[model samples]
Target: MSIIQQMNSKLANMIAAGEVVDRPASVVKELVENSIDAKATNIMIEVIDMGMGSIIVTDNGMGMDFLDAHLAFDRHATSKIMDESDLGHIMTLGFRGEALAAIASVSKVTLKTRQENTEGIEVIYHGGIFVKDGTSTLNQGTVVEISDLFYNTPARFKYIKSDLAERQAIIDIFDRLALAHPNIRLTLVMDNKTIKSTYGTNDFYSLIDQIYGSKMTNGMTIFEQTVQKIHITGYLLSPQIARSRKKDISVFVNGRYIKNYKLVQAVIDGYHSFMMVGKYPIALIHLEIDPSLLDVNVHPQKYEVKFVNESILAYYIETYVKEALLKQTHQIPETLKNISKGLDETYIPLNLNFGEAVISESKPVYETQNTEKTPKLPDLEFVGIFSGTYILFQNEEGLYLMDQHAAAERIRYEHYFNSLAHPNPAVKHLLFPHHLQLTSDDISVISNHPKKMNAVGFYFNEQNDLVGLPIWLNDSEVEIAIEAMVSMIVEKDAIDLAILRDKLAKDISCKGAIKANKALSLSEINSIVKNLRACENPYTCPHGRPTLIKLSHHDIERMFKRVV
Candidate 1:
């Protein structure tokens, strides 16, 4: 007898289950994809016993007949692909035909399906064995109930994550699928509570509003870019609305969700200089390309894909997203109709002397202190300050409110950043060499990186005390600046000179900028505004809070009911 023998069907199925049904989320993914492939307009997923106990997926789609339903549990039985040639051009979300079989092998499965013009049938399976069959009077759709996941395989069941973790995985998959298929009415319920739901409006903006909330609509813009037959379309959020994680960033290819780091990076790179450190913007990117140009069969779970023309895809995505962001900057945002309802502009308290303001029932106006305007200053005429924090101005385009502190920070950050980048540091000899005390770790870091200290214009004495300092910094500020750079290295526990220099610049700028509640004269405010306009990215501070907010005159009129 030959040493090698073919594995039995049950054994083969159990082996395949390792790939298809790793946890509750994997089973949900396979079944949901099957429903999507069946042309389902509406789908509902219900998780019970925190995902380890059971899962139910119901769909209003063209169901399978009795024979096809039975074969659905058999290995290598599929109606998606006919032969080998169909592999290159895969259109459906699922085609492997192993999901149902592999899933059934590990759990108790009950499937009830009724196709059009056919009687309904209910089939049950336990641990990959055909248990029984029954007749049912059901609608023309499918209902799949999977219970006791990993029951037959205790080893695999032990590796499953906690209930909360498993529930999160299921929610993640459901969100991805719902985002990918905005036209489908998707609902998800966990432990008797509906967790997620979307209408079948075929409008992605509406879907986003439903999921993230209506206020998020203010921070996002839609864009569509085409190259020949391929089309890239989606919504990209403003940098101000970015979050710390890339969790909100989603990518879809021809209505199928995928995980592609290069594509995600391309979207991030589009923000370029506008983004803050370690932050990612909200992006929902959809790419419509020829199915022949992509390979969706690369991954067992069908979440990863290989593209034939990824470079071209990345180029268009980066280019169009940048263009969209630029366009958004120039366009006026839609105004809320009742924005100024409770705000009384005419009321000026008796004790207040808010610079050069003439309050009237019609409209309030403020005169600028400087009659002669310079080119560097913005064309906007100066209005009074609001609460001593924001400087108000009016131009032909709109009403502008500049946060004094944030504006000054942007100007200061650029100044220090440029000086640090091009280190022509002017040094000053100390009248009395200051003795510096530091922790052993800081001393070791300084000792290891003598060149970094010299590059930042710090010269030490024989005892590692501060002897000389940068001329741009005052004697009083030297200790603070040096400590900032040293503490940054110590905190990170690393020695990247470039990052240390940048952090030092940012810290110095933030410390030196003017703070809120400090009274500023009209000329001082104008000077800050002029310097802010000269900055490369004046819209936001180094920490990414917007420096200014604009309210268009049209928006003001709408709020006052002057415009219908």
Candidate 2:
């Protein structure tokens, strides 16, 4: 016998099942795509036991006849593509013809489909073996039910995650499908409870509202630009509406959801200076390109794609997204305007709750230091402090809101960082000694770093108390701040000098800054403003919160409806 003999059809299908039907979500994806290819206007997905027990997908599309329904179970049987040339211009979501056969191999499947004006046909299969085929009365569409997924493959079943995890996977795929085809009315029901529903109005914004609520929808900015045959259109969420993960960023190419990290980075780059580190913006980017220039067959799941001129495409997306964000500043919605109008603009503190830092009568002991001259930001006329927390200013360019605490934190961080870098050997003794009790190990750790601590302005006494405290901290807060520093040092076995210095600077800056709800005079506000303007990066505090936000003149006019 030849060593390389052809495998049996059943064995061949089981191998294909390894790729096509990895999980319950994979089965859902294949069936729903088939329904979409059939031009389904409304589709419904129902699941039980997190789709491990059973999954049913029903669609109101042009269904198949008896012969076609029977043939559908056969491997490589497809109505999507006819010849080699047809592959270049493939538009339908499903073209491989392998989904149905692969899906049938590992699980029990019951399919009922009826063409318009034709009698419905029901077919049954258990582990790719034909069980029964007969006529049935049904609506004009297709219904596929899959049960006991991966039953034939115990190894795959053993690796499956918990029920909750599997359900999340299913939900993720459904979200992508809904985003890609916003015109299709889609509903998902898990364990008899409806979790999602879309009206199929062909309005993408409405779909966004349905999925992420009205707040996110209102914060979104629309972007559209065409470069050659590639058409890019989508919405970018404002920086304020950011998430910790990239899960909210949705990208589709030619109506198929895909994962392209480079494209994702391009989208992030679009936010540029507007976004803080480790935060991702919500994106719904759609790309329409000639099928020939794009390749979607690389991944088994087809969630990744390859296209020509990727760099150029990324640049185009980045450029337009930047433009859209710039325009967003000048286009505040009426709802936001109405709310802003009710508030007193001159002294609207806007709730600046920066942590537990207290306001003390003692002032910061420092001289205004010189700075290297850089490009100057436009000067603003002081309008006084809002809520005793924010510094309000206005000029020809726009209205500016500066977080009092953040500005001081930024200034203190830079001041301490520079002092540490140059090693200022100045220690001012306090009139009253500060005391903190700690474990022996913590006391030993602090003793070892006495010089290092003193360098950062904390001189320790023999009794684990501070001989002198940092000038920045209030008398009452010095013990807590010293304990925090001691705890930080204790947590690490050995600390890098640079890392230690940075940590010290950060702690001191946070504790020393002016707190929210603390009143400030005009001279104090001017001093902070002037010092902030002189810093290298005064946009955000050391902790990465924006120190100031500008409401442009154009935005003010737009808010008042002075011009359309």
Candidate 3:
């Protein structure tokens, strides 16, 4: 007998399905792409049980006929692409015909479509095998329903997350799609509740205001630039309105949301000097270029793209955004002054509570000549604590409120990170081992890097389908920590040991740290300050939010009209 043989058709299709149908979110993405390709003016997505039980997508577009509906579930049967040359200049959202076929192989699928000139038809397929085919009386549109997702593959089904998490993923996908197509009215319903519904408006600014709040809209500056064959148009938020996370930045290329790090970095670099450290500004950027210049088939999910002239594109993006920001600085509108002025309003002092003031002007003595011997730590005197969360402090320059938890998280992250750099570090042993059940793929990935985990104070034992977790973690939080760590490792193949260690440490720290409502003693406040001063990057936390913000005496005086 031959050692090697061709796999069966069913097995081959299941393997392909593994690549495309990763979760309910993946199914939603494929169906939405098909709706966009069909030139749908209005799209609606409804899900039950967070899309694990059922997903229904209805669109008002030029629907397919009976023959086309049957061929849609066949591999390599796409109306978008016919010849090999068509791949070079692809304009449609989905070209490869693997979506429906791959999705059908893993779940029970029902497709109903009707064209303007033909009667409606319905087809049902289960596990890539046809179950029922017949004409159906329906409205003048297309509706595709997918149920029992990943049912055939028990291993994949086991990895489905909580309903809340899956719903979040679906919302994220819908947000991206809505941002790209502002003119297409879209409605998303989950478990009989309307999550999002948008009117088909051509006004981009109105759409931005709806998605992001008024704060983002107030800081937004419109920009449009065209260089050679490429056109760029979008909104860039002012540096003053910055966020601590990258979730606010949205970028779309030719109506497709992508995660190109190089492009995002280029845009950030353009706003270099205007933004404060650890702050990221919001952006809604759209880029248009010749279809042949970009390739979107690089990733299985189509979230990443490869460009032919990346260098040139990067340059144009940087230059255009930089110029736009520079020009806006000179265009601040002046308030119109009344010629016939009434009596000048008297200044009234509002009873403002300036929390605990620890550092009074009389506290510590410092001699300039003694600076040569040993640099003294700044005399950060405590003011008053605010809302039991922020620690108000005063120094020679200004008043600052320090977020104790954020500061502690940063300190722990740096310490844990530095410990990982050493050859031998302390590893706290668990008194009782914790068992974690994971998918086979996750187990394979974890097994491949046992040494890396050992370096970061984690030990695991694989037996059957469960992995034994370290005893250091509490029994309740062990699952969450493991899941987070596993997700991080899978997303970033080569795990930076330091980053992993810090992430784990931060996760542990946040849970045990004092909450905002908790009252603190004077000693506790002092301890927070001491720990913050020890941190390498004391200004920002691990999540990149400013730990402390300063308001100088000079600024106070200016605000009070005491100084120019």
Candidate 4:
């Protein structure tokens, strides 16, 4: 007998399952994509025992006819594409046609489907083999129920993750699919309880709010930008509510969620100066590009894609995100931060609290949208300084408490940031020569970018000593400013002024700002408040920390139970 022989269809499909159906989430993703490709406006996915026990997907989409109802279970059988020419321009989500076959190879499947004004049919398959076919009395659409997954291939169970892990994985996938198509009403149920729901509402932000939970969209802003052939819409949350993980940054391409690190990083880079180190913002980027420039067939599961010019696309995304964020003014939200961050890591209990997100067969809550923006700071009267940290201020609307250190940082940061970007600057003559102490590495890093240093108004002498300082720099902070500039140059490992400016601004602002537990005279306190109000983004420091918080008179009364 020949050592190498053709494998049977059952074995082939089972082997293909290794790639297409790695976990319960994989099954959910494939089934949901199929439903979406079927033009299903409403889809429901139900799972039991973390999907190891059973999985059912029902959709009110265009169902297959009697012939396709049976053939859909065959490997490589597809109605999505007719010939090889269609491979280059795949618009449907299930073009490969291996999902049903691979899913059936290791489990028992029952499929009921019907077309408009046609008789319904039900088909059964076990281990990729057809067992029986019968007439069905179901409505227009298709229903797929999978039981005993990986039953034939018992060893596959060993590769499965834990129950909680699998549940999160399934929910993550469901979230992505629902996020990609907001016009479709999608629901996910686990153990008879609804996990998520969206009701064919085209309001992207409301859908995002529904999926992510109430108050999650508190600091988010939406904007759209278009290139020659590509248009990107961004929904970016403020850096004040930054998260520690990359999972919250979602990117979609033509209604398909894809994984592209370069693009995700671009979104982060746009927030270079706004966010603290090690923190990331939650955002959704939708890239609508010509299909001819996109290659989605790169990854086996189609999670990643190849763009014609990935770098250019990333640049646009970063620029647009930065512009959108810069256009908005923010104030410290007194109740939003503590409540939002206090929730569980994963979204939950939203169906009860969010009347706008989760709903029944009624009118959309966001049908008439009410817009809200972070209000501008009002002119405040200096009450007093408390603990040498918080400066108290009051206006007719509310009471304001400002962090003296953070407020100072924001004021100085804008000054240095603008000075660095200026083409021409005035250098301040030092009354006495200030000697600079720098390691050889620091000198070398600064030496490589002499022009950049001069452009920012920091020049060094032949002995590696400072000659003069920028007019914007206070004489008291001469040594500290040079040290800050050098550290940024070394940390960034390059002389790029655009990147160096932000780092230097952060370092200089924080290092020179007044410290806590220090005394400030009434005049000094008023000066700080006046300067802070002049800043472009006075609400936050350079490192994205809130500089001020508001407490309404009603809030104080409620806290004391006097308002009730």
Reference-based lDDT, each prediction: 0.73, 0.74, 0.69, 0.74
> After best superposition, candidate 2 residue 49: deviation in angstroms?
1.0
Q: Candidate 1: deviation at residue 149, Å?
A: 0.5
RMSD of each: 19.5, 16.4, 15.1, 24.2
Clashes of each: 0, 0, 12, 0
> What is the Cα-based TM-score of model 4?
0.61
Tell me which of candidates 3 and 4 scores higher on lDDT: 4
Superposed on all Cα atoms, model 3 deviates from the true structure by an RMSD in Å of 15.1
**Model 2 regions more than 4 Å off:** 1-5, 331-354, 357-564
> Per-residue alpha-carbon lDDT of model 4 for 1-564, expressed as tens digits?
769989988888899888999888899999989999999999999999989989999999999988999899988888898887786777777788899999999899999998899988999999889999999998899999999999888778887876656776787788789889989999888899787788878777678766765455676788898897898999887665544457778999988999999999999998765654555777899888878788887766889889899999999889988778766545324222222222333211110111122122243322332223323468898887665467799988778888776776776676567656754568976665676533332454456567767876877777666777777666655555555555455444334677656766765565445212235666556556655555567799898999999999898888899997
lDDT for position 12 in model 3: 86
lDDT tens per residue, model 1, 1-564: 779989999999999789878999988889999999999999999999767878999998999998998999999889999998898888898888899999999999999999999999999999999999988777888999999999899999899875545765787788788889988999988888787789988887777766654445665778987786788896886565534457668899988989988888888888764554455677899988888888899877888999987887887888888778767764322211111111133211111111122112232221222324422334778999886567899999889988776777776676666556646588787878786533322444465456667777888876677788876664544544665565544445343567755666566555445212246776667566666665667788788998888888889999999997
Single out the weakest 10-residue window by summed lDDT for candidate 4: 346-355
Candidates in order, TM-scores: namely 0.61, 0.64, 0.64, 0.61
Superposed by TM-score, candidate 1 places the C-alpha of residue 359 at a distance from the truth, in angstroms, of 35
TM-score of candidate 1 on Cα atoms, chains taken together: 0.61
